[model samples]
Target: MGRNTRKRRMPLATKVTAGAAALALGGGGLVWANFYASAHEDGGHNRTKSRGAQVATINCPDVGQKLTKVPRKARRGVAKELALLDRQITDAYTRLAETRQAQAGDANYVDNAILGPLKSKRTATLDRIGININRAGGTAPRDLGRFARCQGVPVDQPGDGDGGGQNQGGGQDDGSGQDNGGGQDNGGQAQNGPVADDFINIEDVQPNSRNLPNGLAANGDGGSTGSFTTECGTNENALRNSDNVIVAPGVSNGAQHQHDYVGNQANTAFASDEDLANGETTCRNQGDRSTYFWPVLRIQDGTQDIDQGRPGGGQDGNVGKIVAPTAAELRFVGNRTSDVVAMPRALRIITGDAKAFTNGLNNANTAWSCTGFEDRQVTDKYPICPEGSSVVRTSAFQSCWDGQNIDSANHRTHVDFVEADGTCSNGFQAIPQLQVRLVYDNIPAPRIENGQVVNPFAVDSFPEQLHKPITDHNDFINFFDEDLMNQMVECINSGQDCQ
Candidate 1:
């Protein structure tokens, strides 16, 4: 929904490798292994046992040399580190390739399944891993390196808008003291370069959405939503800003109006033409990266207004929203903030209390809210569930669409449409028309003050905000912002699905 948040202070020379595998505690096994080999004296460090004997020398392919003149001990250590770094990079590269291939393998797989959301996750993981790899002294593939050079990719900061930041005009200081020069400074110019997304692995996902058939009407976009447009180009005019629209705790409002000006205007200030176009590429590419690991929005049910506690007719539809655990709330309730805390534990804390989510928006104390809409009647005299409210019969809708819960092994049992007239079926046009809200990595955050992206580490403000993002269409046109760098920063800070 916003800009990238993956940029860090690390230089291009110092890289770090991270992946979905890394997202798992086990993935960090390598990081620990490397640290162990580099740490403490006993078994951790310098041993006469010598991996040197195990270290095989190889000729440098690019610079045809035997490459064995360094100190034996140092050489061995470097080799070991290089080998580890190579494996990490190669593994990540393989995963990224597989993800991209899988994305193209089957349109249905990409659309109905996890392509959009997982792609974003994969991208983020890749970016992290790249950072790690660089840190570990690895270099980008020569081809990528050359591309960055030719394109003059900007340095990792503003003004260095080139591919690698060697093109800052005369290296003039802007007085902000920020190093904003490097590559071509297209600060105001339009850039039509190659699209770069976060690294993500397709094979490491848990299948979190309903993988329904593509032809279903419920899954198709209604013309009313309009054709998708990129953040770049003349097509950006179609973007819808979905900021601060609240979902009543228990009622399913039909898909709200996707107006051009409905979202927070503060974010719009950073709208540079290049940022818009490039940001579209970043958003769509990252969105695609996220789908392999998570679910993307296939269809958006139009919105309906809540009439008191009762749902309006034609508007009373079943709606679903992807709810994620906020990092802040977890920090408050959880004993430890380490990644060692399993997903189940995090899920427990996030969903364990409704008050945490509802009240998180405001500093003021609000009532604990647990109101989900269901298609059944309840007796008023019965004691109400405090965390959640009972569904009222009058509040139900007539036609409804439901998402396929691909995460569930028994997806066939629950993923289908229902008639509003109280009938169970899988076909479209069922009486209980349902509205499904696909969870994209797009988190709803206030706009950045200078149109610049926020630091990933600075999201401490609202840790309870869940970042499971979904992309209705993994096309650049669907993104709301411009500024690929900014978009990347946003994704990183919010910890949502991004590449």
Candidate 2:
């Protein structure tokens, strides 16, 4: 049986709420609402408590056993390192509290500079502790306990035998001075301390560099310039899965956060490349069924904060949640002299690297700015929004395609951006450029934390740990309906401004 001939289970249509209303067919349609609240109240999804609800403690199981098993000669060094690690963990907690207190008024600053570095420092320390422990011929424990005391709890618990505070569930201390079980420990509540095998060691992967011929200047022919816009409803089933076939597809544990998807109603973590190519679409024009996705931007909202502290922290907080943007602005920019060719089916393109968040640079296409303050562009770092303004994330994909290869080995080599002269490079065909602008409605009333105003808006990545708010990444799959795509091509080639 052929692939399309086989009967396939149709994916369920996503349930929409005030946050994600039906896609309005028009230019710049906006939908603003409390996405978190709407999902919890109307979407039947259970929301987790903010990290503040969880208590922090330092408890490692089998420490005694592991210590005893170590060789006598190396025991002393291991013991010394372990003690140092304990102190370092405590210090990390102290620093975190102090930073939070200092930057409570500026949540964006806290996440961008203060919290992320602190988490990385703690992770490095943990990695050292694990190395020393392993060197002593002992295996390290998985749950090392929280690194700091919970709010309202004393830093030093007097009655607690292990020196750590009471566990979230109020479980009795397990002789080891750590609560063995009870209330769920919010992953973001404590730092995991980096392990030796942590995934951070992987280097940023880039597409093979290609030298292409430059195409004609954008308006060299003096043809009038034109553009078109497509608006689609955001999917609420935003999930973080390791199933990326574009970058590091062989690695199943890619860390990610919630992604807001448009176009194919069935687009999801489990959706395969073939599925997207063949799936039904939710776009206004039935023929324009290409899948578009990007990380969902979320606001702190006071009730819950962003977490990206744990090793798998990417999936820790706000997993399976969706924060719909006011509207997804899809505009095509191209030469007025030439009509754009319909995007080939199953063509995969990735703009901005998610892993680049750690280094804070490398990807140049990612851009951030305040909605009204477009002149001020921010990269890698988030800009503070004035009382009246909101945060905006803008991503532009490469517009030149090889016209032959649907995909490249690096997932980007097949595509290139138009030159300053507006011509395709290396014989690559110039297509209508797709630019996405996502606007986040700032919290009407900023939450007061420690007597300071905390901006609620945050990018979907690990804000507290990664620190790179500009790691704004986006993905696109062209499964456009043949006729609609042709219309878009006609509009662009004819130099007609289209809606």
Could you list the CA RMSD of all candidates, in the order they appear?
27.7, 19.8
The TM-score of candidate 2 is 0.52
TM-score of each: 0.17, 0.52
- Per residue, candidate 1 scores C-alpha lDDT tens digits across 46-150 of 222212111101101110011212232232233333233222322232232234344344434322333233334334433443344445555423332111100
Best model number under TM-score: 2
lDDT of each: 0.19, 0.44
lDDT of 2 by residue, 1-499 (tens): 0001111111001111111101111111111101111111111111222322221221111122122234434434544443333334344434443443344445354344534554465556556556765776667545433331112111122222321222221223446543322111222221211101111101121122111112212434543356667866545444334234343333332233555677776655455667776777767767767778776655443244233343222333332123577656877666634556778877877776553322212332455665566644444335555667766677777777889977653355577766555656578787767787877663342332221223334455532222234356788878876777777778877777676
Write down the RMSD of candidate 2 (Cα, Å).
19.8
